[model samples]
Target: MQPDQVSIATQGLLKGRRVLVTGGARGLGLEFARHAGRAGAAVVIADILANELHAAAEDLRAEGIQAQSVVFDQSSPESITDCVVQAAQWLGGLDGLVNNAAITNSGGKALNELDIDVWDKVMAVNVRGTWLMSRACWPALKASGRGSIVNLASDTSLWGAQNLLAYVASKGAVIAMSRSMAREMGVDNITVNAVAPGLTLVEATEYVPKHRHELYEGQRAIQRQQVPDDVSGVVTFLLSDLSRFVTGQVMAVNGGFVMH
Candidate 1:
């Protein structure tokens, strides 16, 4: 049973596409890379965690998928530029970019008691990193002529959450930036969109207090928590030709947690 023999609805949806997924070493990013690779896309798993990225790539390759790993630091503008260049060179040009790298910390205090340093770090990684990555990949995306960009946003961006002001604010910026990018790139045939996940149980959310976790659980009409697989499908759709007519939209995969 070879990978090419696997039967799937979106089989070979990206047969000749080259995809670069930032922060793809683990968790949701890893899931995205796996799905895209399985769908016959040549995936470049870029992450700051070099060891893990290499391992993930190897695992994919073992499954007969065209996958590679590159060391990348999304938070640094220079690093992001270098990464995009290397990735484009390695993949022979990019068709899709996943801006999924972000930093999140539990700011236990309210606005008055918040640490300025933590706030800066959060914004730097989430907002600034996303912007830099998108800009660096702009030329390659334009060249692809059917390019797509998906930014990982959070449900908090749509609605405010207490004590997590920095994360919320950064995601809000992601949504806005994505919309603007979509408009700017539409003429180039590059679609930009955002995926907002509501309280997904990923490594990034481990620090969230139990009460806060419960809050999300209670809000979900489905009465179930979200998993990485829950969000990966929508991401794949947005990156595939199925979404060619879709742009500047924020797709939520929160299991009925957030209607918006």
Candidate 2:
């Protein structure tokens, strides 16, 4: 959708809604929060980075946006539950959740070279974290009657990156979990979906090998790397009434890098 069309559709569409975004301190998560706030939703930014999360929240508040921040470690089950409860209380209720917290093992290590500890850590945050957050927010979301959950996935899972086995597997799990949750929650009027983003220029992806990035560049039909805003718009749409009929789908935001 074009920017103008999105603006028209979401003009105050989320007015009075409350949203929670995990890992929302920076990068794409920040972008998602900004857009949702601009659309008139009260946003709760949660992240493991206390300082960064607070700074982001202050910045949003500076813009006169209704925002709050909470420190949350996605890899820890206890932290996930606590964060969800805190956010729900802060926001007075919950209407949506963006499971954007994730970590890629340092360097694109193949499965054989990947350390077991790193593998477990990745799964704990990326896969298990998503499940825990969603489950924890189930009751609050059900209360909203118009609940939506957007899980952050990746193009690596779709095309199978050569050396990011652990990250790829986790993202693949996110897609599957999202589908199942969508099916299970559909009867309750809750919508669950995943956003599989292509390689985007962010602090996290800066460490990716140049050659690997070039490979992604070549695959993108648009011939350009993705930006945070590119992915944020779709997330906002999915959380809005515009996509009320959409669920259990993986919306790829990779500039056509992984078309399906």
Candidate 3:
């Protein structure tokens, strides 16, 4: 489906919820923001891509969704804190946080050949960034009295995909961290969950080899390329009041690629 035609079945499911999505300039992040906004939540999309971020928020506004944009660098701690402040201020408070910013700089490189700097960068953004963003958003989310954190993981980590050690390891950390965070934050009525998507067809995965893409497609039960919407709905559900009792869980939305 075209971008404008992407329909969210649960309209007003997130009514009165304020959401902040990281790396929301394009691809899956953008789609998650769109779905949340369509579900009746005001959204703030933060990204390092200034131009695309603003343009995306404008597009959402044009569609009559309450949306805003903030520019932030996921690798920088100060930036992550500032982004949360800006987003929370804009939305009055944060009800949901989507930790979607991540890097695959170590992609296509074997563990032995991967540069230390590349591995560190991936960890800094994918692992540390998620932690800090969630930390910074904690107060606002807790104040909302019903907060949900959705951390973006990858199925590559579950199946131990080769030649992508840094990213895989980082997402695995995210999965573990989400569970820990959930256990600690459940007292505050906050839910922390991880969503692991497969080899999705998004801008971020454009560099994935054709053979790898075919491998994902041929091995999946759905037998087709996965789109952003396939995962966005679950994310929206998690962010909404519907999942108030759910916490500390990992939902793999990979078309049955990793059935666990």
Candidate 4:
């Protein structure tokens, strides 16, 4: 959905907030940034894809959102640290963080069949990257005094989806980490939570098998295709003041695919 089409209910929800979204060049990450911007937040979108990242920021700017882009590689701890420093500098301290950058190199491969290097890469980016980025942004988030962190997890982890062991395990770790991080950061007024989305239709998910999509559609309570819009609103709420009392929780925005 376009930034101009943001729902009236969420307008001004994040007024005066500053947020940084990882992997904001495209897909769900881009949608999260758009929603945050529409809610009146100053946003910095970080990604490894420099060209697409800049283009997305320009698009957000055209819609009158305060938006900027930074390039960073999630697999590198140095890059993650630098990205947070640059983002926080641009935003004058961050009120919210969306850890949405992750890789699924082990997709379609069983644990036994997955290459060690691919599995390592997935864990490095999805698990370690999330940890490092959150740590790097901790001080800035805490300084905001009403900080919020939303880690983008996957429903696959909850249900134990096969053939994607590395990705599933990585996201599972994120959910667990969010809980512990919440407890530690709570004293500082920083809310940490995880959002688990199931099989959304986006550019990154185009490689998902048709059978898997059908399975999700058949099993979901909503009985329809999942879209980025469906999940982005929940992330925005977590970032906004409305959820100040909500933290250390895992919300599954999967149309009842997994109610737990």
Q: Which candidate has the highest lDDT of all?
A: 4
RMSD of 1: 2.4
**Collision count for each candidate, in order:** 0, 0, 0, 0
Candidate 3 lDDT over residue span 143-215, tens digit each:
9999999999999889999999999999999999999999988988899999999999999999998999999
Which candidate, 1 or 3, has the higher lDDT?
3
lDDT of 3 at 8: 42
Give the local distance difference test score of model 1: 0.87
Arranged by TM-score, best first: 4, 3, 2, 1
Model 2's lDDT to the true fold? 0.89
lDDT (Cα, tens digit) per residue for candidate 2, span 160-210: 887888899999999999999999999889999999999898887888889
Residue-level lDDT tens digits of model 4 in 1-260: 45444446699999999999999999999999999998999999999999999999999999889999999999999999999999998999999999999988788887889999998999999999999999999999989999999999999999999999999999999999999999999999999999999999998999998999999999999999999989989999999899999999999999999997
C-alpha lDDT (0 to 100) for residue 65 of candidate 3? 90
Q: Can you list the residue pairs that collide in candidate 4?
A: none
Q: Show where candidate 3 strays beyond 4 Å.
A: 1-6
In model 1, the worst 10-residue window by lDDT is 1-10
Which residue pairs of candidate 3 clash?
none
lDDT measured at residue 131 in model 3 versus the true structure, 0 to 100: 95
lDDT score for residue 51 of model 3: 99
The clash number for model 3 is: 0
